[model samples]
Target: MSYNMYLSALLMAATCCSLAISYLCWKRRELPIAISYGLGMLTGAFYTFGYAFEIVSTSLEHIRFWLRIEYMGIPFGTVLWFIMVLQYTGRQALVRKWLVATLMIVPTITFVSHHTNEWHHLFYKSMTLNYSEGFPLVTLVKGPLYKLHVYYSYSFFVVGMVLMIQMFIKEKLRMKKQVALMIIGSWGPYGFTLVYLSGVIYMPIDISPFGFIISGVFYMWGIYQFNMLRLAPLALQKVFASMQDAVIVFDLDNSLTSFNQSANRVIAGINNKWIGQPAVQVFSQYPVLLEKIKQGPFMEGKVQLAGHADEQFYNVHVSFINDKNQRPVGKMLLLSDVTDMVRSEITLLENARQLRELNTFKDKMFSVVAHDIRDPLAVLVNLMELMEEEMQTYGEDQQEIVNEMGQQIHNTFTLVESLLEWFRSQSGGMIFKPVERDLAQTIQINIRLLLVRIENKQIHIISEIPKDTFVYADKEMLDLIVRNLLSNAIKFTNFGGTIRLRADRSDHKVVVSVSDTGDGITSDQASMLLQEDYPVSSTGTAGEKGVGLGLTLCREFVHLNGGEIWFDSTPAQGSTFYFSIPTLSEASSKQSDSLRGGRA
Candidate 1:
C-alpha cells in the first residue's frame, strides 16, 4: 500500500467505527445524544473528505464528485448541531426550517463549482502543483469561494456552539458534572476542525474521530449519573408523597403550586378546595383565625372548624413569601393540630380558677363559724349575769358595764356569721339555691345583725327596698350579700348619718343599693370594695377594724348565682354598695336556718 492508501485505510476504519457508534446512539432521546450525533457526522464527513483527497487525488478533475466529497459534511454536520442540542437539552424548538436550509444550500451552491474557476471556489478553486522530492505533493489549494464557504460554515458552527454553551451554563448549577460531559459532546466537532486546519497532523484521522467516540462514552456516563444522583422527577415525587406534615409550596400569586400528602388532606378536608386556590380562602373558615391576607401570605392562628365532628383545633403557623418590597407573593401554611393542647390549657385554667375560688371560701368559712359559736356564747354570758343578779344584788356601774360588754359580744357574732356565709358560697361544695323572700323582710332581718352598732352610732336606717319587691338567691348567700353591703354602708356612715336601702327591678333583674351618708370612701377604696377574697380593710368612721374580707365573698356568691354587685360613691359624700339578683318565686320566699358559710 502506498502512503496515501495507508492513510486512507486508517481514516476509513476510524470513520466506520464512529459511524457505527453514531448509529447505535441515534435512538437516544437525551440532549447529549443529539450532541454526540452532531460530532459523529462532522468527524465522519471530515475524515471521508480527507480520504477522498488523499486516495483520489487524480479525481479532482471531476469537480462535481470532488465538490460533493468536500462539502458533504457542511450539510450533514450542520443538521446535527441543533438536533443534538434539542435532544440533549430536550428543547425541540431550537432550529427552524428556513435556518437549516440557508446553512445547507448556501454552502452546497458555492462548493459545487470547485473545479472550473479559481475565482469561483466553494472549498477549493485550483490545486497548486508542488514538489516533494519529485514525489507529487500539493501545497495551498485555494478555492476562490473558499472564504465564503469558510465564513458561512463557521457562522453556523459558531451559532450552534454558542447555543449549546448557553444551555450548558443555564443548567450548570443543577447538573455541573453532567454539563461538563455535554460541553465535550457539543464542542467536539470544532476540536476536530482545529486539528485538520493546522496541518500539524497527529495520527490517522485527526482528533475529530476520537472526539466523536468520547462524546458517545460521555453520553452513556451522563445517563447513568442522572439516575444515580436522584435528579429523576419520578423519584422526587415519591419522596414528597411520603411526608407526614402537609408541605405546600406556593408561588408569588399566593396560588398553591405544590403540596405533599398531609397538606392535600388538610386542604381537602378543611378548605374544601386548595389546589391552585388562594390560601386565604381556606384559612379564613376558622373563627379564631383572622385571615390577614392584607398583611402576608401566611398568618398564625387557631382553626375553629364550626361543625366538624372531630372538633380538632389546630395551631397553624402560616408563612409568607414576599417580594423585595415586602408585598405578598405566595404562602406556605403549616397546621399543627393543637386541639389536645387547647383542651389541656382549658383544663389547667379551670383548675386554677377553682383553686382561687377555694381560697376565697376558706376566708368566708372563718368569718361565719366564729360567729355561729360566739352568738350562743354571748347569750350564755348574759344568762350567767342574770343568774348572778338573781343570786345577789348587783351594783349600778357593774350592771351597766355587763350590758355594754354583752352588746359588744353580739356585734362580733353578727360579723362572724356574715363572714362564714361568704366562705360557704365561694366553695362549690355549697350550691346556689336562692330562696324567695320579701326584700324588705330580709333587710329587716339582716339589719338586726347590725343593730347593736347601729344603735351605738345613733345612725338612722332608711329602708327604701320595696316591701312588694323580692329577691331569689341562696337564702344564706342573699342574706350575707345584703348584710355585708348594708353593714359596710352603716359602718362607714357617721354617728348621725342614715343608711338608705333601695331595691328595684331593672331589665328583669333586681337592683338593691345601700347608700350611706357617712364620710364617703376614697374613689380607690370604692373600686376595691367588691373584691371577693382579696380584701381592702380600712378603719370605719367609728374606728372599726375588719377581719378584712366581707364583700369579696358577697360578690363571688352574687356572681355564682347570676347576680351582680357594684358600689358608687364620692369621697366624703358617702359610698353605696349595690347588689342585685333575679327576683325569687314566692314559694322560695321563706328563709332557711341552714348554716351558710361567709367572711367578715
Candidate 2:
C-alpha cells in the first residue's frame, strides 16, 4: 500500500469512530450538553473524512474541492468544542444565542471565502502539488484571512481548555475524575494544532485530524464509562448563594451536607468547615436549634437570639428531602429573620393589655359608686313623692321648688344608669346570652319605660313592627339599645312631634329603625355620636342634660350582637337611627333547642 493510502485508511478509521460516538450520543439528545458534544464530534469527523479524500485525490481540482468541504467543519468544530465545555461546566448561560451566532459568522465567512478563493486568494495565497515521501501532498501558503481564522480557532481552543481546567479544580471529589478525563480529551487536538501552528514539525502533513481521533476516543469513554451525560452539573449554586434566608441541608444520618451564604449570618459561628460534620455537633453552640433538629424531620418554630440591648427573632421551617421513590434522604432547614415583626407584635399586645387593665379598673369604680348611690336615689325619689302629696301645706313658691328638685334627681339617676351600662360593655364585664325574642315585645317594653318622657314631650309613639318578628340577640343588650334610642328620640323631639318604631325583616336579618320628626342633628354631630372616644354631650331640644354615653353604648351592643348601626340625619329634618340583627331562623332555633336539651 502507498503511504497516502495508509494515511487515508487511518483518517477513515478515525472518521468511523467519531461518527459511531456521535450516533450513540445523539440517542440521548434531550440533554443539551450532550447534543453539543455530539455535534462537535460529528464536525470533527467531517473534517477528517474530507481530508482523507483530499490526500488521495489524483487531480488538483479534486483536492481543492475536498479542501473546501473540509473548511466547512474545521472552524465550526472548534466553536462547538468551546460550547460543549461551557455547557458541561454548568456555565451554559454564558453561551447566549447571539454569541453562538457571532461565533458561527466567522466560520460561515471562511467557508464562502475558501470556495471562491481562486478569485481573491483571501483564504489561500497559493496551492501547489509536491511529491514527498512517495505520495502526492497538497501544500498551501496561508492568506491574511487564513491567519485570522487560525487565531480565532486557537482562541476558542485555549478558552475551552482553561474553562475545563477550572471546573476540574473546583468540582467535588465525585466529579473530579470525570472532569479530568474531559480536560485530557479536549487537550489532544488543541496540543497538536499548537504544534502545527508553531512549526514544530517539518512534515508536509497536518496531524491535527489524527489528534481529533484521540479526542473522540476519550470523549466516548467519558460518556459510556462515567455516565457524564446523564449526571447534571451543580447548577443551583447561584440560586442557593443569592437566597436571603439561611438554608442548611443535612443528610439522612444528620450530617450537614451543604449550606447557603446567609446561613453563617443567621447562625453565629457557622462556616464552611461545618460541611460533612454531624449537625448536632456543628450546631452545639446553638442549643435551641440543635434540640429542635433532634425532635424530628419536620419542625416549625421561632427562636430568640440574645442581642446587645434586645433580642433577635427568627422563624424556622424544616422539611425532609425525599428520593425518587419517596424515601427520606435528607432534610433542609430554612431560617427567616422575623425580629421586626416579633417586636412590633409584642409592643402592641403589651399596650392592649395595659389599656384593658385601666378600662377594667374604671368599670369597677363606676359599678361600686353606682351600686352605692342607686338605693339612696330611690329613697330620695320616694321621699319626694311623699312631699308632693303634702305640697298643699306649703305656699306656691315652695311647691314649685319641690317639683324642680325631683326632676333634677330623675335626670341624674338616668345619666348614672346609662354610664354604668356603657362601662360594663366597654370592660367586657357583660355576658352575652342570645335567644329567640319577640322584636315588637322588646320595643313595647322600652316604650313603656319611656312613657313618662313621651307624655312630657306630648310625642306620639307609632309602632310598625310586626308582632311575630323575632331576632337572635342578648335580651339585656336589646333592652338597653331600645331604651336608649327611644329616650334620645323623645328628648330631641318637640311637643306634639312623632316618634316611629319600624322593623323590616329579610331572609337572614331584621332591620329596626327609630325615626323621630324632631329638631335633628348636623352631619358632624351624627358622626360623633357613634364614636366611642368622642365626647358628645349636647342638650336635648327641651334643654335636657346628657352625658353622651347612650349612643356609644348602643353602637357597641349592636356590633356585639353581629349587627351594624348607622344614622341618617339632616339639619332641622329629624334623624332616623337604623340597626340590623340576625333573624331567628327555624333551623338554627331548632338546633339551639336540641343542644340545650342535650346539655340539660
> Can you write out model 2's per-residue Cα lDDT over 1-600, one digit (the tens) per residue?
678788889899989988987887676554466577888888888889998998888878999888877777887888888888777665655777898998998888887888889999988999998887666778889998898888888888878888878877876664677788788888777787778778977757888888877877887777556645222222124576688888887655565656777888877776644544677777777777776676656645446644312355678777776544565556677888876676566556545654664466457546545654565467667767767666756534455656666666765676678766655654554445678899999999888988988888899999999898989987877888999899888888888999999999766789999999987888677666676443456778888866555776677678767689998887787999999998767436544443333221
- Per-residue lDDT tens digits for candidate 1, residues 1-600, read 356556556556556655654554453312234344636455455646554454435433453344456454644565555455444443433345676576567646653554344555445544544434232334446554666655665676676667667756764354556557666754665677667766777433334444544554555565444421211111124555576656555444344444556765555453213433445654555443435433444545455444445555655666764444554445555566666666566556545665576566666656544644555576667867775785577443456556655655755665565555655554656444557677788889989988998999999998876677766667777777777787788778888888888877886578888899978777576556665344546778877755455766677778755677777788878877777687653212211111011000
Which residue ranges in model 2 land beyond 4 Å of their true spot? 229-600
Candidate 1 at residue 491, lDDT? Answer: 74
* Residue 81's lDDT in candidate 2: 84
Cα TM-score per model:
0.35, 0.45
All-Cα superposition RMSD per candidate: 17.7, 15.9
Worst 10 residues of 2 by lDDT: 227-236
- Candidate 1's C-alpha runs over 4 A off are 1-175, 178-244, 248-258, 264-336, 346-350, 353-357, 360-549, 554-573, 577-600
TM-score of 1: 0.35
Please state the error at residue 555 of candidate 2 in Å.
17
List lDDT for all candidates, in order: 0.57, 0.74
